[model samples]
Target: MRLGRVTLALLAAGLLAGFGSALAVCLCGYGDGLFTTNTSITIDGVMADWATVLLDTDNSSCDGAAPGIPPQPDRDDPVQSTGRDLLQFTYTWNGTHVQTLTGRAASSTNIQRFIYYADSDNDGLMETGERVIVAGWKGSNRRVDLYLGHYVASNPGGDPMLDINGYSDGYDLPGTIPDLSSTGTPDYSGDWGAVDGVSMEWEVPWADAVGAPGLGLAPGSAFTFHVSSTNSNPGAASFPDQVDDNMGGCGGGAATTQYAQLDFFPDRNLAAAAGTTVYAAHRVTNLGNGADLFDLTAGAPTGSHSPGVAFFRDVDRSGTWSGGDVALTNTGGGTAIDTGTMAAGDTLYILIQYSVAGGATGTATIIATARSGFDVNRTNIVTDTVTITPLPRSSAPARWPRPFRPRASTTRFASKTRVAASWMPARSRSPTGCRPRRRSLSVISADRDQARWPS
Candidate 1:
């Protein structure tokens, strides 16, 4: 049907306006050979310094971390850097990408800035690392770059990687070993971050982070380790790049390089001390969605030149196991033995005896395998290191101070009143040191004319 002149005019105007809006969204067309740059653009409304998954537009289910993601290899354990702190990045991606990030905790716990994220691309958050190596590596500017941590390495690549075993025993977060949630002193700073750029967050139950009491990991139970990154857009082009001295998946605008490096290390090992046990917890967590525990195929990192690279397993359920590259039985669950296939949020604990073995000093390395599920190119091949002390000793005992224990049924008392009835050891101590002191009877509680010790 032929429209009137007025109607036609209005229709033409509306069509033209709609086209203009689409053109704006598409930035019209990129002039050939014109590589427009972005500082940190807003992606899906969020500013990203690099090609970070801005929004989960496809709603891809990173809902749960992949189950059975083996515990990280010792050398590959997530690193918490020193002197060099925080992770930073700068990015520019050609297309819109969807990224899923979550901070799942064991007990409805919430971490504020607890998990760090940044803006790297001008597309308003064009990229974000899967795990923050360092939080809020500060920088405000035109290039898409976010700061995380400082860099450290004397290697040839200059592109340094984190050394999980190289970190110092950082500040201790005091709390008792929690049943599910840790309120007691937990080595809170022990974190494993992934810069493979697949910045998805994994919320694991407390049970997974720690092993059951007593059933601590045995010496030398190895497990798989990994660091990976993924872009929701199948078309992202990225490769390994460094930001904030952190190495991650850097998008190359139409060149996405899905890569993973996996290796093996003990779930838990002894701290660098002799005669004293520093519970080194190496837990293999399930990073997949399914609820079954899969067998961890053990591969000995055999090399002629690599000495002291011993592997062991407690095959008989006896408190002891042979120190070699294999174990007959894979202990899983319960106290004193937290090593096994875990359900979606479960973890297996493998303890290693990490001390100056054979009077050797320097570093130790162990390797494991990645059989299936995760992309081998993106989830296999990793490494970790255990350092030998600089102190010269013949298997000397290096121990932290022990906590004070109560004497057998000891009883003591204090009073404020003169001639007050009170009692304590004659060697009672005061700010001035153990001295003969006197107290007044008035300070004694009326309810307690006398009190009995817990007899």
Candidate 2:
């Protein structure tokens, strides 16, 4: 049996107090597309580990009209300009930090800059949001500086530079890593890595990146943002067009292109045989943007028959076979399977072996549930049934016939029917009658000397 929505909510009220805000259960659509995951991603320059999360950016040149057209060519304007045509990128977020990888960096010969704007309130205007500018890059010492500030009619100089001689700010979060510090202390500003002369990467804690006096952004929170780059001559006064803008830039609709959705769903139910040896399988996937740690446990079975069972995993994504995947150790009764760690967008298969009892016949239903940070959806539980039937029995034997034996011939029976010969002959004619009358005597009287029948 499953609990109703109301009962689940009441129980969750107490169970979820320790955990952070719950994730909104929904599907993502549009923009570079929204992604959710439950795995911790490293912020190194190489983006091999970004398999779980998705990257959102624009590619159309500004030459044609909106919608089906390329962005307009670069002009002598900084506010409304299309910087580059092939500005490709990728990104992902753990609950605490956001990571971004750029396909094309600001051209070295020309003065190029990237502005990352975030509207935490989702009002479509930057008047009440945050913006981070990465500009003034030069060779050696990686002269790309990062600045954070609230937006208004003009540029609000990010007071204490976030990345200047290792001087970073403290945004008051638990176990936060530092990017840079001004007082020669440990604090995070923005950590970046060099991919190539034309590409770059950056990682920043959400609290510091969203530059507010006392503001913080948690997982499952929705917001609008724009990623734009400007192009200009080296040390020139005017900047040009910004192409590949995910959200329409400073002048257009500037609408929210993406909505952050968090969801964890198990594919379907499983079934297996009862008496015979068989396996039941289920796959659980992480559909959220941040890395999540999940706890897996089995609910009590519906039937009385207890099938001998064990769980296994496909660690290398190969088909589970001997010497390929490993068995998981049982953690008491009804508890998490294995270490219970699932990365975002990663799927883990649950292989359960059912060793049904000798005479047990019935449908045994087992419920497998996966619980992660704030993912209390009841649909996340998958139900599996093991049906067993009894084996057939043998029938009784037939009756026997009466005992009988025919008189045997001197040697062997040569005819189809056996004929018994008379011991003595009766009177037929006058001569034969007298001969037969001599007598029919007992074997003892006639054959006293020869021990034969009388004739």
Say which candidate scores most in lDDT.
2
lDDT of each: 0.26, 0.42
Find the candidate with the highest TM-score and give its number.
2
Estimated TM-score for each candidate: 0.21, 0.34
lDDT of 2 by residue, 1-455 (tens): 25676664554343222212111111112333334444566654344443334322221111122333223221212224332321334455666666655534133543345555565544433443344334333322333444444443223432221213221111000111112122222123323434233444565565643332211465544445445554432112232122323322212223232332233333333344445766655566766534444556667778867777666765564433346667775342334554254444667765666677777776777776666532333225666677775555675546433333333322112322222333234544434232222222244332234333435
Expressed as tens digits, the lDDT of each residue in 1-455 for candidate 1 is: 34676665554344223222111010111112112232243332122222212121111111111223322111112323221221111222223221222211111112112222222111112122211221211111111111122112123323112233321111111111112222223222212222221121221111212232111112111111112221111111211222111212111011111111223334322224322222222335554432333334333423211223222333332334334324324453322222244444444444333333354444445454332232222233234444444445576356633444434332234543223333454664333333333433322263554533333
Give, for candidate 2, the lowest lDDT window spanning 10 residues: 168-177
| Model 2 TM-score, all chains together | 0.34
Regions of candidate 1 where Cα sits further than 4 Å from its true position: 1-280, 292-341, 353-359, 370-382, 390-455
